[model samples]
Target: MPWGEFKDTVAERRIFQHRTLVALMLLFVMMGVLMARMYYLQVIQHDTYTTLSDKNRVQVQSVAPTRGLVYDRNNVLLAENRPVFNVTIVPERVADISQTLSELQAILNISEDDLDRFRGRLLEPRRPFQEIPLRYDLTEQEIASMAVHRHTLPGVEVNAELVRYYPYSELTSHALGYVGRINRDELQRIDPVNYAGTNYIGKSGIERFYEQALHGKVGYQHVETNARGRTLRVLERENPVPGEDIRLHLDIRLQKLAHDLLDGRRGAIVAIEPKTGGVLALASVPGFDANLFVTGIGVEAYRELNESLDKPLFNRALRGQYPPGSTIKPMLAIAALDSGSTNRERTVWDPGYFQLKPTGRRFRDWKRGGHGWVNLKDAVEQSCDIYFYDVGVRMGVDVMHDYLTRFGFGEETSLDISGALPGIVPSREWKRAHRNEPWYPGDSVNMSIGQGFNLATPLQLATGTAVLANRGVWNQPRLLSDVLGDHDFEEGLFGAARDDIILTDPDTWTFGIKAMEAVMHGTKGTARAAARKAPYRMAGKTGTAQVFSLAEGEEYDEEEVRIRLRDHALFIGFAPVEDPVIAVAVIVENGGSGSGTAAPVARAMFDAWLLGFPAPDEPVLVKSDPGAGE
Candidate 1:
């Protein structure tokens, strides 16, 4: 042992004890701080920590309310909700959305539209962990495939949802319209919380008009979820209230009759109940199957519909604007009588045509020789153009515009019909604004007979005819008969009330109706042949509207022109004239004579409603007189 490295056992023991004491103090301090932290978390902030922890295990999910159902007057289901499976994905649980989408495409027959729609919805504002639909109406095979790969795809799910379906798709396409996926515009306008899980919305017609009533309140549930965002159990739930079911005044039997009557034709028919203003039947031919639009119509199929010449999507009853032609004659007679331009005993001699000026253009009548001598009753019965031309000119545009407006010619009058156009009733102001031209006397001459700038929809004509049937009483046309719920249908839903059209002479209504009655029963009545064997009396007026102007001394030959370019046939009438129940307006495009083509259709409709001629399942055989008169 070296002398300098001498052992010192006592001093070494003191140094070792001091180091041991310092290490113990440090460990005790660390342990005290750890205990304080544990106490703070476990006791003081227990609720906050538990809440944070439960957030991972539980989620509040939105549940969509079932859509309402639609029924006809006889309780036939028009529109309903059908349960269907859809492929869905929750983005929060998806590891790689792109990769998952690709995998889904490999397993399913997904189109570009499906991918585009999915991406669109993904970009749209949504709540956390909400399931977005990828493909709708999945087939059984697709569902099985998705089930087999469910474990591999974390966020993928097969969700069953109720989708809107129209049973009589083709029969009621225009009347009921349809539902489709909510678009960006709709999303911005809708309440985010209420429509959280809702996907479809009404697109048009009655569905769109009463959308709020049709879509019910949303509900929610607190669900226990696993690490992969899969719902394990429902902790709490609030069931949603289903929408109110609505019943319409439309009769399916009558509607089917109208459709069958107009089969193979491009035209429209609107039948209304004069007493209640309830629409009985509204039919537009060449209608499409509304089902095609419900589940996102394909691009190719939509293109075909959009480009079709027949215009199957066009709602001719409410939207189609036509010249109205001689259908307004009965209405014009009322105007002339009320304005004192002519009286019931007034007579005009027809020399085949009327000259605005002695040498100016001659407005020829449909009859070649003439209806030599005609009174108001005689003219209306015979559909004599010369008599109407005289009265129309005498009444002029101002008096005619004011009086005809009362008959519902130039405005939308339906309580629930959507997309109805206010037809053009040209006055001095209208001509100045629209045509940017002064109102010429010649314009008045043309408008006097429901030509020139006078345009009216089939619905408008029906409404006007209904007003006539009611004898100046106004019942605004409506489709909503009742709402099947505790909520009573508000009378204010029909909008502002319309005042009755009261004339100075109440007898004028009876006189006008008598003249209209003559149109059906009189020996020389143009439509008398159509009313030949009618059990009940009907008051009607037939009309022929020219498509194009004829040059001076030029004649209109039906054989020389194309079918689409021929004159439109029109008729307006009410059956059982004494207690008019049904008033109708019929238009057959390019069908030549109104008496021949359109009047018979009205007769059939009357028989269907009044007599129930053909059984519900029986086939209809309409006998049309192609060469009948105007």
Candidate 2:
């Protein structure tokens, strides 16, 4: 016990108290800093963090509106919506995507294409916990099978939604068209907010023409979801407004009749009501089932359709460009009379052929010994080529082009359907632009026969025929008759009356109609045989267009060539000549004679529309018009 160690106890105690006070002050400063940090996070930044946390559990979902229904004039459903089951997966909930996909493959029988498409979607930008579809349109058995294994799968879900369905798929595919899944390109172009939950988009025909009206507005809902992102309850909802219904002017019965008439041929038939220009029936043979394109068509099926020899996917009625041949005679006759190129009393001698320049080139008429001294009426009724050759040469290419353009040739026609192609009407500008050659006298002569560079679609021919039936009052051909949408849209949306084709002399219409009538009722008319058994008078014209060019001086012997290389047969007509009802244009590919093949088909349609369709009960009206062809 040293004296210094024992006596310094009070001083050591004071030093220890000083160290404890310093440590307490430092501790108090650290606690104060931590409290301030906590207050900043919990109070000032509270809303931001809470919103982030709630988004992980609660979700705002887009609700797709119901698509519109499409009906024919008789209320027959052409296109409708049907509930289809789709299997979707949420990537966030899927713990091991590979394992989950394998399990889904076993349960859903997913194809390799489905997996590829799913992976492609996964690469694209999307909302959190959004369902990505793996397969569409599941069968009842598949749905039941998925339900049995539902508990085993965490992120998988079976979603039900309405999809487009065309009941008369083959019959009305060209008229109604179809919808398909929206693509990346379409996504860039479409309204993101409006099409939020929408998947399918209209691809062609009427469906494409009225896509906006058919696809209704999008809706929204506040939903509470669990940790796995399953919707537990709907907190608030805004109901969607459904799409409007559309009614077409097509008559199913007449459409079927037209189809039956052109059953075996690879040609098109377009029939329109003379008054309103409402298309009664538009048929292109060898059509495909339009449903194959709705829900992501398989590569194999698409390839098959794309490679088919018959071209079932082609809309021949609107897109097919064929040589108009004698079908142009009626239009030319009107042109000849109205343009002051030729008079009705004019006549031309045909020694079985025509020449742009004598001893230059001989363009042989269809008959070896041609029509003798053909007049304008005889030229149209018999479809005499030599008479037109003289007139066409006299009028020249420019006048013919201008006159024919007025008749809707070489133009888009501006129809409601999206597939119409503006057929070629050979002009000096068109020839120089496309063929890089100048228009020649021989070109004019060939155009007279609709041979050289002249091209016209069946729709164009039908439209021209309808114009004739309407007597210069042009009504553009249309399929949509009524659109039952919001704000009385039916009148505004569909069946709009187009501009008329006003003629210089209205009496020229009577002249053309009288000549067309002679085509079926006259003694030596080309299509006179077709009018033989008919109970009603019809104005018609027969046409024969060469499929392959005949070599100089090579005769056209149809039986010698291959079936596909033979001439195309065609006819155009309207029934009950006094007050026309139906105007039709029929074309039969490689069927030899227009009178023998195409004329009969037009006669059948005329009978079905004028006589057979109206019941016998309306006897007075039916008997009022003269029966038994002249």
Candidate 3:
């Protein structure tokens, strides 16, 4: 046993040495592989891994620019941005959107409209991690409640944003219009990068006209976020550029005066500064609050406004088209003189009515027993339909159309006023195209008296009157006076280039002005009562536009016809005939008489703008005077 043990010792030693060498070689190989992997990760793929890590901790966000401020000519703020709290949600971070929305509804008094709007917006294409607004204008209590329950909600947040507000909402609704939330159609048309975080866009009026200058450039920021996607800090920020501030030609004092003048009525008054073509005041009565549409008008509120019989939402100044009535006499008189159809000395016999032929239909004048014989000046002063009927037929449709177009009729003439209609100026072609009928001789007669197929907006009447006031010069009606920033105001926008009217005889302009002046100052003038005791000499033409036509020989009974179907009162005029400062157009819906109802409104506007009397706050009552005729 001792001899066997001694003989195995050398073998055992050799076996142990070999086993130790093999173990050391295996350990060295494992160490080399580990070092190679460490080098590949730390050196070769360093940028890639670092970028991945940062993606989990950081986020890029868009910063919205502040919308431009809007002010009147006197620096009175019309539209402004007010800070508001809104509840927003990030879809990617929410585990269940439906469940989260339910929770939000319970937390806040969210209406079904808001929920529906949110859900609809959720399906629209958007940025990967954009925060969608759920509820707007949250109260402090609602904000506190949301904060208390924030932990349970993953991706919900309360954000402060600048929302549009109108200080004189009711007065300026149709003039300034309003902004609204950007819809999907707007998103597609807008510059994505520039409007990334923007929510509102101009919908109409001054807001829509200068949208590009009002909406500034967007910005970007790098923010650090936690594992739960909550923003911890802003790493880098590129401050956004604020929009350009705009000042309108609108005078707030004059606007208020115009509104007060039309108090308790359904009507419109447009006043323009003739020298500069600046719109001083644009007032549409029974106007709804424009502020209601800023955030989002309630369904019921919007429905009520949309369905109201008074049509408070209608922009009568720019869109309401009606027969110009006898108010068109001044312009037609100029046409007659220029076309050699009639002379200042030419006289037409008016026996209370006119007929194209001896056997033709009798076109009755406003006066039951009209003035016997009248010259051009006498015709204009009396608002005589029969005299115009004679000259209008001589001048023909083509001549009237050409001259009226030059005076800014049958077409949109405003440079910045939006939604203005090119009122109907019936010609052979127009009648053929629209009504599929030939132009009738009676059509020309009706058009001569501002009836039949001829229609015009109050703004158009005002613009035409402005041209007349300016001695055939076309300034192109505009609202924007100046822009207070890098952006400059663009002129001649959305309108044809200006071409001043030059007559064969330059004295025609002077003649037209004098004839219009006679309408206000002359003893037999239709609007003489309205212009009585005026310190300055003004030019005016009053008219009564029929709401419905009478049957062949059927007499008009104002008492029998409903108030809604009564004649519309109209007046177009300008103050201080020598200097020609302000041109105005006034229309009172179903107010009966132009001299009685509409002329007084224009007188008040003139007094306010020129004389600064009967202050805006003064309790001035404008009543219909039966003595005033035409």
Candidate 4:
């Protein structure tokens, strides 16, 4: 041990202390540089970093808007929202999806389709933690079973959703239309932002036409979430605007009545208010339930509807095209009177048949024997085919075509409802263009009786009858009265103003209307025997449209012909002759004589709507079941 060694150890210790101090000082300077760089990134560039941070934590979720409600004129609920329990799965939160589904299937009856749809949704690349719908309208048993296993199945949830329901399922189906799931084609057309989480859209009829009004505006919510992507609390929210309700002009009571009256009949009945043009009822028989289409319709049900021979999916009221038949008699009578072809008092000899000059082809009348000499008024009252044929030969087809076309015969009625058909009203020009043939005198005679190349829809016939009831003033038919907004606000949607129709002369319509009245009221009237002392006075015309063409000397054989091939019976009428309210048009497919079959249906509809369900004292006239006739 020496004093010099102790001194050297002391010097080394001092040198080590200086080096440690220098290293500590350098470390502090480097730490300061790092802190300054962090400040620039976190404080100066706060907005950029904040957005990046939120991207990792927060997510945007879509909320669906409440759909609108539908009501009849009397405020009877037709379409409404019903609470439905749905089963859902969150992909990111699920531990074992297959095992969880197996447990779910044990309690609920899950169809093969349900599993496939769920799996398909899972495969799509979407946002993390999105709730995929597993099954809709889960039963109570399913909910209870799921509740017991909710804690174990982390991502599974049971939610209550609003589903569309139709109270009168088939009654207002065609008129109200239906809503269905949004498909790839529909999603392209819809605004993804506006639709938000909604999956259904209006597919047809009035629902499709007024989709904007029925689909409410979407809203937003800022929700605070946990690390597991579970909602902790709603930080801020903006409630979605509820869609406006729609009130229809249709009378549900009358609609039901008409539907029942048409029971088993393969035809259409359209009744409208002559003055206002509000359709009381537009019933097409064999209607389908609209609820089946609310969600995705089942394959079997959809196939049945599309393949049915009765064409349940067809909107017969607006789209069915049929021959006007003898119903055009009133229009012919007006044309004859207006064109000076005959006077109201003019008389013609009815020899039971009419012959074309030179060709000498005898056109046989409905009556095998003669109707005897009859005047214009008497001929119309009795529905004498021979008398009309004679007048038609004189009037000519070219003239009749021009006159009938003016009455909206060849064009669509432009009804408020969709899918209206414009029936064919053939002119000399049309015959030449379409058939490549010349219009002859014999053709004119057939057109006179509404038999040759004359066609119309039920809606057109009803509108025409309404025009006659209102004395040539045509009002466009409307099924919707107004659209109702929030706070009970209403705006007139249809029937604001009526359009005047083209007619030869006002006097001619009056004469024809009076003649139609005689058909139901006069002793010789064809429809008189069938109407049988109704409570209110009715003005009507009965028509029997031929279904096929006969050979040179052939006649119709009812037994030999199939029921569907038989002539169509038609009747057009209005109630309380002087002040008409409801103009009814009824077409009974292959139903025997218009007076016997079609007029009776019109009578029943009139009595129910105008006269309040027929008094017990009033005569009960029931139409025989259409199936029995077939």
lDDT to native, each model: 0.89, 0.84, 0.89, 0.80
Q: Sorted by lDDT, highest first, which candidate order results?
A: 3, 1, 2, 4
On lDDT, who's better, 1 or 2?
1
Number of clashing residue pairs, candidate 2 = 0
* Rank ordering of all candidates by TM-score, starting from the highest: 3, 1, 2, 4
- Model 1 residue 473 CA deviation (Å) reads 0.9
Off by over 4 Å in 3: 1-23, 488-496, 549-561, 613-616
What's the TM for model 2? 0.89
Q: For model 4, how does the per-residue alpha-carbon lDDT over 52-105 read when each residue is reduced to its tens digit?
A: 777556656667788888888899998898999998888778778999899878
Worst-scoring 10-residue span by lDDT in model 3 = 487-496
- Listed per model in order, the count of residue pairs whose N, CA or C atoms clash below 3 Å is 0, 0, 0, 0
In candidate 1, what residue range of length 10 has the lowest lDDT sum?
Answer: 486-495
Residue 100 of model 1: what lDDT?
Answer: 98
TM-score between model 3 and native:
0.95
List model 1 lDDT by residue over 137-223, tens digit each.
989999999989999999899989999999899999999999998888898898888788888899999999888888888999999
Error of 4 at 40 (Å): 4.0
For 30-139, candidate 3 gives per-residue lDDT tens digits of: 99899999989989999999888899998788999999999999899999999999999999999999899888878899998888788888999887888889899999
Residue pairs with clashing backbones, model 4: none
